[model samples]
Target: AQSVTQLDSQVPVFEEAPVELRCNYSSSVSVYLFWYVQYPNQGLQLLLKYLSGSTLVKGINGFEAEFNKSQTSFHLRKPSVHISDTAEYFCAVHYSGTYKYIFGTGTRLKVLA
Candidate 1:
């Protein structure tokens, strides 16, 4: 059971305001998509990926996502958000002859500067 599900653990905005962080995945085969950002102690930072062909994917500070294969879902967006984009966002999955990495128990983006 390869899985990744992040349906908001926390999201409090104020600074520039505008956010959406929700992801869902359950893989049996093809998978390789990641969105990671953890600021407050720093480590993970690879803001976007969808691996295959385009289904609307963009990365880095601005952020963007839309890979919905019949609602398997991969949702993340940032319109107007700053405060250095207060961090802690993880949604990862890797399949297809694995190196094994499945996450998504985090989504704490509190940007209120």
Candidate 2:
């Protein structure tokens, strides 16, 4: 069984500063991972994904993630962040040769001035 772990439950950063949200998953037969962001009172929106090819994947809102096969990690990064960027981030993984999905708890990003 594989599980996803978001290292930080809450991250507080100053506006315009760079940030990196860490995510790690246990190794499995095949790796299908995704990153999603949720604004207040809104559902999750796809941020980026890693199905195959290219370890580095870019997504909307200037967000990107790099899949490290050796580390079993898909850490999200942003050169700079805005106050509007404050939201809950999540990661989903499909592993263990099953159709079932493993959803991450969430990593709350609090962008301060």
* Highest-lDDT candidate: 2
**Model 1 per-residue lDDT tens digits across residues 23-91:** 899846578778899888879989899989999898988889888877877899989998888889999
lDDT (CA) per prediction = 0.87, 0.93
Count of clashing pairs, candidate 1: 0
TM-score of 1: 0.33
lDDT of 1 at 98: 81
What is the alpha-carbon lDDT for the whole of candidate 1? 0.87
Q: What is the lDDT of residue 79 in candidate 1?
A: 90
lDDT of 2: 0.93
Model 2 segments more than 4 A misplaced: none
Alpha-carbon runs more than 4 Å astray in model 1: 1-14, 17-31, 36-51, 55-77, 82-87, 104-108
